[model samples]
Target: METAQENRLNPFLYLTYLLEKLPQLPDPQDEKALNALLPWSPSLPLICRVFTPTK
Candidate 1:
């Protein structure tokens, strides 16, 4: 059985862990990868915005 403390995970720490484990975003020019991510044709700017990391 899990305790209440074990069930509670820090949001910030969880986000950090997820970000660390996330693979690098594929290049916008890579058609195969972009196709996998988007169903329809996506513009360069859209891809850039989606993949670009926020400060």
Candidate 2:
């Protein structure tokens, strides 16, 4: 992380790298709480297809 800061790495490129490196869990059985943090959106990909429409 220090190296990235020192080298002035591009923020977008760093974000892409971080996304690619993140674990892609198929199941949301243990992710209900985290899922609650993300608001449903038409643009974001349907990761676990667990969208709860607002009433």
Give lDDT tens digits, candidate 1, residues 1-55: 1221243433344345435433555565666654443322232223222233579
lDDT by residue (tens digit), candidate 2, 1-55: 4443443444445445446534454554546533432333233333423335689
Candidate 1 regions with alpha-carbon error over 4 angstroms: 1-6, 24-55
Model 2: residues >4 Å from true position, as ranges?
1-7, 24-55
lDDT of each: 0.38, 0.42
For candidate 2, the lDDT comes to: 0.42
The alpha-carbon deviation from the true structure for residue 15 of candidate 2, after best TM-score superposition, in angstroms, is 0.2
Task: Report the C-alpha displacement of residue 5, candidate 2, in angstroms.
Answer: 5.7
Which pairs clash in the backbone of model 1? none
